[model samples]
Structures are given as structure tokens and as C-alpha cells.
Target chain A: MAAAVETASHIRAARRGSIRGSRRKALFWSYFFLVLFVVIFLAPPFYMLITSLKSSGEISAQVNPWWVFHPTLENYLGLLTEPNFVTFFRNSAVVSLCVVAISMLISVPAAFALARMKFWGSATLATGVFLTYLIPESLLFIPFFRIFAFLRDITGIEFLNHWWVLIIVYPTLSVPFCTWILISYFASIPKELDEAALIDGAGYIQMLTKIFIPVALPGIIAATIFAFTVAWADFLYPLAFTTSADQLVLPVGIVTTLIKGDVYNWGQIMAGSLICAAPPLIIYAFLMDYYIAGLTAGATKG
Target chain B: MAEAVMSGVRAPAARRSSLRAIARRKPMIAFMMALPLILLILLLVVYPALYSIHLATLNRSMKRFVGFGNFLFLFKRDTFWMVVKQSVIFACTAVFFKTLIGIFLANFVHTIPTKGQRKWRGMLMVSWVIPTAISSITWFWLFDPSYSAFNWLLAKFFGTAPIPWLGEPLWARFCVILVNIWAGTPFFMIMYLAALKSVPEQLYEAAAIDGANWWQRLWYVTLPMMRNIISITVLFSLIVTFANFDIVRILTNGGPVDQTQIFATWAFQVGIQGNDIPLGASVSLFMFPILGVSAYFILRGVRRRSQEI
Candidate 1:
């Protein structure tokens, strides 16, 4: 009996050891592939930084493109001082801010109504908002282009080729998604808090401002980040609508003005691209949790 | 005693009337709140979408109505068919690889200790966080024919000749799709990771006890649990990838004899740049059928998920 019990216990211990051994092996491979993917994923931006630091002459000389042996800050200095680059930066900032403001102003109230109040067609309207969010800007830009031209012809308002026009166009892209996101957020808030606020004689607008907005601040931040990113990163609208160098936003400006036809200025171009990419990247870095939460919420919590 | 009874009855009646008034006022207030959103959608999204159809029916000069003329023109052209083929291929290939890579990376990230996952995830997501236009420019530089970094490394390590990345049609298409995969895979990774986290660990343990291997566990356990999210993510990525413009525009511009032209770029080329608005509108409208179908699936998926919850 004692010998049999010893054998059984020894067998159990061996099994446990093998299981742990397999787990360790799995973990080692996981980290191995994770490091591999991370390198591949980050290569471009890393390359951009590397290239941006090199002078034009060094870039042209082709002395090991991977490393910048004699790195220079001329590309950064040049773009910073360049009026066109500054104008592009300013235009992108203004457009992004205005779009975010407009998106919030429109989406918050709409989301509140749809999520809380049972109005006529509110459910269908909410679904409609989601469907509209799926409509790519590529599909709409053509008609928008013609419409702006038609308006220009009829009212002489000069709607085309101006950066401010982007402020108007961008909300159409942002508001629907923002409203959809906020509706889900507002819907997730428990029913009791709003009921208590209503019992306290809070008006519809007052309840929305005092109760819903603060509680859903994370959602609001996520939505704002999304709106700002959409506005800032938009290439099609700004590319198609605004063509003048002075009126162009960062993405379009950097691409069109910096390249200057086949004579690609790699240093300044990379520098400009890096600068253009900064705001969204910084926002993502800080508010990553909110951003990821918002992203998953769209699919999982819908 | 008569005064007390009368006052109590009057108070109940007054409270009922106020409640009814609040109920009556709710719809109007809701309408007022939703008015801006409604107007924006009606005037901007719905109107332009329908207007594009009407615009497609018009002649290039807009003086005459030529129903289906532009589409007929497109049907007769090889480039139009090429655009359709390339667009489908690009969307399909990119989404497939993205989904595969995403699931693998998500599983990898999931296997690691929770403490280290955040750092790894953040690092992996840098490619996606950068704007596509900016990143595509970097890619374009990397694929530059004369001074290609990829080729430089290839020559140093493997003694390979410089590749004509964008100068050749096939390579251009490959480069565009590769850049897209690079930019988009991180999104799939993040989404799948979230889904992975939600999957109950007990299910995997059960599979392991039943003598399921790693692949079997993934096949039987992980994929089944993540089916809804996978479909949703794939569908979403499909729509976006099909309509992608920036990568193609900045990287190749549908160049090397227009071999890399997708619907978006082709539309831009024909409509905006080519000075044929009707033709461009028609080209863009081709995206509608696919987009509409995917959008339908997404709506259904969202509704079902919401219902399930």
C-alpha cells in the first residue's frame, strides 16, 4: 500500500512538472513573436525618425539609409521656419478643434434624447446614425465637390478651396460616429441616477448637462479624441476641397507642397510627416485606455 | 372632514395632469435635441449620397441627362474592370492577412502576463496611431526606387538587386496592399485582444483537459467565442479597406500604368482630376453595392449583439 501510494504521488509530480515546462515554452515563443511583430510594426515610424534626422546631402549620398551617421536638425528647423508648413499646422489645428466642438454640440444632445427619452422614431433614428457612420467620405466627396461649386455659382459664397469649409464638411464625418458612441455611453448609465435627478426637478437640458455629461466623461473624451483624429487625419476632403497652398491642411499640404514633383525631399518630407502625425499620436499615447475602450465598445457594447 | 377630502382629491388630479404634461412634452424636447443631428445627416450624408446617383445620371457638362451613360462608359473600359478587380483583391488579401495576423498577435499578447500586456500593446499600435497619409509617405520613401531602404538592407545582407517597388505594376500593387496591412493589422489586433479578454478562461481549461492541442483549442474554443467580433471586425475592415484612398494616393497614385487603381483613386482620377465628374461619380457609386451589403451585416450584427446582451 505505501509503495503504491508513493508511485501515484511521483506520477502526479512528474505531470505537474511537464505541464509547467510546456507553459514556459509557450511563453518563450509568445515573447519571441511579440518582439518580432513589434519591430516590424514600428519600423516605418522609426525609419521616418531616422530619415528625418539626416541632412539632404547625406540622404542623397546613400551612406547606409538605416542609420544617420552625421544627423542634423536642419529638416526640423527648415519645416518649422517654412511658412507653408506652419500654415498647414495651423489649419489642421483649427479645423480639428472646430470639428470637435461642432461634433460635441450636435452629438451630445442627440445622444441624450435617443438613449434616454422614448421619442417618435428615436430607435430607428439611432440605427440610422450608425448606418450613416459607415458611409465613407470617398463616396460623398464627389457630390460635395459639385454641391460646393453649385453653391459658389449660385450664392457667390466661395465655398470651395478654403480651409474653413473643412470645418463644415468634417462634422458630417464626425457627428454621426460621435453621436453613435455617445448614445451607447448614455444608454449604459444606470436608470436610477437620471430618475433621481428628474425627481429633483431637473429639466431635460439641465439633467443632460449636470448628470449625463459628467458621468460619461470618459466616453466624451474618447469621442472627442476620435473626432479630433478624424478631422486631423482626413486626407480626402482637404485634398479634394482645398488645393491652394495657403489654405491646405497638414496632410495635403505636406504631400502636395513638399514633394514638388519627383524631386522628393526625403528629410523635410519625413520631418513634415512626423510633425503632422504628432497630435494624434500624442493623444493616443495619453488617452489610450479611453481610445481602446471606445473602439471595443463600438463592436462589443453596441 | 369635507374640506380635507376635497383638497386630497384636487392634489391627486393636479399631480396626474403634471405627469401627463411631462409625457406630452418629451417628444417635442427629444425632437429639438436631435434636430441638429437630423439636419446634418439629411443635408450632408443622405442628400449627397442620393445626389451622387443623380449626378451619375448626368452628362459630364451637366447640361444633359444621360442615364447610365457614365456606367456604360466604365463597363466598356478595361481600367474600370481593373479597378474593380484590384479593389476586391486589395480588400480581400489585406483583410485576410490582417485577421490572421491579428488573431495570432492577440493570442500572443493574451498569453503573456497581464502586467506586460499594456506596454506590448502600445508599442504594437504605433503603426496604426499614425495617420495613414503620413505613414504612407514614409512607406513611399522606403519603397523609393533609387534609394530604397528595403533594397539597401537586402543588398547588404542577401546580395539582392534593387526592387522596382512602385515602378512595376505588380510590385506597386503589392506595396500598396502591404502598407495597408501594416497600418490595419494593429486595429484587428486590438479588437481581437479585447474579445480575447472577454472569453472565459474556463472554456480553454476545459478544452485542455479534453486533450485539445493549441490549434484545436483556438479552433474549437477561441474562434467560436470570438465569432461575432471576428465577423464584425472583418466586415468593418472590409468596408474601410475597399474605400481606402490615402495609401494608394500617396504611395503609388494608381500609377505604373494605373495597375494599382482602386475605386476611390480611380474616382479621384476620373472625376476630380480627369475633369469628368459624372464618370467619377459613377466610379464611386460602384462601391455602393458592396458597402450596402456589408453595412447591412454590420447593422444586423450590432442589433443581435445588443439583443444578446
Candidate 2:
């Protein structure tokens, strides 16, 4: 009996040891692949930084493209001082900010009503909102272009070529998604808190401001980040709508102005691209948790 | 005392009437709250979507109705068919690889210690956070035939010849799809990671107790648990990828004999740049059927998931 018991214990110990061994192997492989992916993923941006640091002459020279020998900030300074680049930056900022504000104003109240208030067709309306998000901006830009022209013909408002047209156009891109995110978020807020507020005679608007908004602040932040990113990063709308250098947003402006008719300005382009990419990247770095939460919530929670 | 009694009687009646009025007005109030959203959707999304269909029916100059004429014209054109074929290939290939890579990376990230996962995830997510337009510019420069950085690296280390990345048709298609995968995988990874975390740990522990190997556990436990998320992400990615514009437009501009033209770019080329608004509208409208089908599945999934919750 004693010998048998000892053998069983030894077997269990061996199994545990093998398990540990496999786990360690798994971990090692995980880290190896993780590092590899990170490198591949980061290579372009890293290359961008490397290229942005090099001078035009160095960029042209047949040497290691990855390494910058005589690093310079001339690209950065040139873009910053250039009026077109500055205008592009300003236009992007204004458009994105305005879109974010409009999106919130439109989506928040709508989300609240859909999530909490059982209005007529609220459920169908809620589903409609999600379905609307599935519609890509590429599909809409064509009609919008013509519509602007039609409007200009009728009202004499030059809606097609102006930067401000983007502020109107971008919300259609943003509102649906924002409303969807906020719906799920506001839905997730428990019934009791709102019930108590209702019992206390708080108005719908008051309850939203005091209760739901505060509780769902993280979701709000996430939605805001998404809105801002969409507005700031959108290429199609700006590319199609606003053509002139002064009216162009960052993405369109950088591509059109910096490329400049077959003579690709690599140094200045990289610098401008990097600078254009900064706001969204910076926002992501700071609010990554909210951003990820918002992203996952779309599929998982919704 | 008589005046106080009269006032008290009126107060209850007034309060009760107000309560009833509020109950009656609740739907109106909700409608009022959602009015801006309703109007925006009606005027912007729904109106433009329907307007595109009407626009597609018209002639280039918007004077004549040519129902199915544009589509018939597209049917005859080799480039239109190529756009369809390329769009399918591009969307399917990119989404497939993205889902595969996303799942693998999610699993790998999940294997690491909890403390280290955030750092790894953050680093991996950088590619996605950078705007596609800007990232595509970097990719364009990287793929420049004369000074392709990737070619230089390969030539330096592996003694390979420089590649005509955007100069050749097949290579341009590959480059555009590759960039799409790079830009998109992080989103899939992040989504799958969240799904992975939500899977109950006990299922894996139980599987281990059953003497199931790691692959069995992953196939049985992990994949099954993540089915809903996988489907949703894939479907969503499909729609986005099918309609993708920035990478292709910026990287190749449907060049190398227009081999890389997808619907969005082709639509832009035909409708806007080519100065045929009706045809462009028709080209873009081709995206609707596929988008509609996918959007249907997605809605059903979301509805089911919401119900389950």
C-alpha cells in the first residue's frame, strides 16, 4: 500500500513538472511572436520617423534608408512655418472639434431616449441607428457632391469647395456610431438609479445630465475619441469636397500639397504625415483603455 | 381654516393632473429628444442613400433617366469587372488574414502575464491608431520602386533583387492588401483580446483536467467561446474592407494599368474625376447589396447578443 501511494504521488509530481515545462515553452513562444508582431506593426511609423529626420539630399543618396546620419528638423520647421500646412492643421482641428460637438449633441439625447424612454418605434429606431453605421462614407460622398452643386445652383452657397462643408458632412459619418456606442453604454447603466431619480421627480433632461451622463462618462469619452478620430482622419470627404489648398484638411492637404505634381517631397511629406497623425495617436496613447473599451463594446456588448 | 382646506383640495387635483399629463407627454418628450437625430438621419443618411439611387438612374449630365444603362455599360467594361474581382479578392484576403493574425496575436497576448499585456497591446495598436491616409503615405514612400526601403532591406540581408512594388499590377494589388491588413489587424486583435478575456477560465481548466492538449483546448474552448465576436468582427471588417478607399487611393491610385481599382476608387475615378457623376453613383451603388447582406447578419447578431444579455 505504501509503495503504491508513493508511486501515484511521484506520477502526479511528474505531470505537474511537464505542465510547467509546457507552460514555460508557451510563454517563451508568446513573447517571441509578440515582439515580432510589434516590430512589423511598428516598422512603417518607425520608418516614417527615420525618413522624416533625414534631409532631402540624404534621402536621395543611395545609402541605408533606415539610418539617418545627419538628422535635421528642417522638415518639421518647414512644415510648421509653411502657411498651407498650418492652414491644413487648423482646418482639421476645427472640423474635428465641431463634428465631435455636433455628434454629442445629436447622439446623447437620442441615445438616452432610446435606451431609457420607451417612445414609439424607439426599438426600431435604435436598430436603424446601428444599421446606418454600416453605410460607408464612400457610398454617400457622390450624392453629397451633387447635392452641394444643386444647393449652390439654387441658394448660391458654395458648399462643395469649402472646409466648413466638412463639419456638416462628417457628423453623418460620426453620429450613427456615436449613438450606437452611447446606446449600449446607457443600456448598461442599471435600472435602479434611474428609477430612484424618476421617483424623485427629476425631468428626463435633468436625469440625463445628472445621472446617465456622469455614470457613462467613460463611454462618452470613448465615443468622443471615436468621433474625433473619424472626423480628423477622414480622407474621402475632404479629398472629394475640399480641393483648394487653403480649404483642405490635414490628410488631403498633406497628400495634395506635399506630393506636388510628380516631384514627391519625401522629407516634407513624412514630416507632415507624422504631424497630421499626432493628435489621434496622442489621444490613443492617453485614453487607450477607453478607446479599446469602446471598440470591443461595439461587437461584444452591442 | 376654510381657505386652507380649499387650497389643499386643489393641490392634489392639480398634482394628479400634472402627473397624468406627464405620462401622456412621455413619448412626445422622447420624440422631441431624439428629433435632431431623426432629422439628421432622414436628411443626411437616408436621403443621400436614396438620392444616390436616383442619381445613378440619370445620365452623366443629370438630364436623362437611364435605368440599368450604367450597370449594363459597367457589365461590358473589363475594368469594372476587374474592380469587382479585385474588390472581392482584396476584402476577402485582407479580412481572412486579419482575422487569423488577430486571433493568433490575441491568444499570444493572452498567454503573457497580465501586467505585460497592456504594454504589448499598446505597442501593437500603434499602427491602427495612426490615420490610414497618413500611414498609406508612408507605405507609398516605402513602396517607391526607385528607393523601396523593403527592397533595400531584402537586398542587403537576403541578396534579393529590388521589387517593383507599385510598378507591377500583381505587386501593387499585394501591397495595397498588405497595407490594409497592417492597418486593420490591430483592430481585430484588440476586439478578439477583449473577447478572450471574457471567456470563463474554468472551461480551460476543465479541459486541461480532461487531458485535452492546448490545440484541442483552443479549438474547443477558445474558438467556440469567441464565435460571436469572430463573426461580428469578420463581417464588420468585410464591409469596411470592401469599401476601403484611402490605402488603395493613396498607395496605387488604382494604377499599374488600373489593376488595383476597388469600387470606391473606381467610383471616384468614374464619377468625380472622370466627370460622370451618374456612373460613379452607379459604381458606388454596387456596394449596397453586399453591404446590405452583411449589415443584415450583423444586425441579427447584435439583436441576438443584446437579447442574450
C-alpha RMSD over true interface residues, each candidate:
8.6, 9.1
Q: Lowest lDDT 10-mer window, candidate 2 chain A?
A: A191-200
Per-prediction TM-score: 0.96, 0.96
Q: Compared with the true structure, what per-residue lDDT tens digits does model 2 show for residues B30-81?
A: 8998999999999999999999999999988899998988989889999989
How well is each residue in B1-309 modelled by candidate 1, as lDDT tens digits? 111111111222235555555656777988999999999999999999999999999998988999988889889999999999999999999999999999999999999999999999999999999999999999999998889999999999999989999999989989999999999999999999999998999998777656576788889999998999899999999999999999999999999888999999999999999888889999999999999999999887877766667
**True lDDT of residue B46, candidate 2:** 97
* lDDT score of residue B110 within candidate 1: 97
Q: Lowest summed-lDDT stretch of 10 residues in model 2 chain B?
A: B1-10
Model 1 regions lying over 4 Å from their true place:
A1-11, B1-18
For residues A137-252, could you state the per-residue lDDT of candidate 2 as single tens digits? 99999999999999999999899889999999999989999988888788778777765676677777898999999999999999999999999999999999989889999999
Lowest-lDDT window of 10 residues in candidate 1 chain B?
B1-10
Enumerate the candidates' DockQ scores in order: 0.55, 0.54
Best-fitting candidate, measured by DockQ?
1
Off by over 4 Å in 2: B1-19
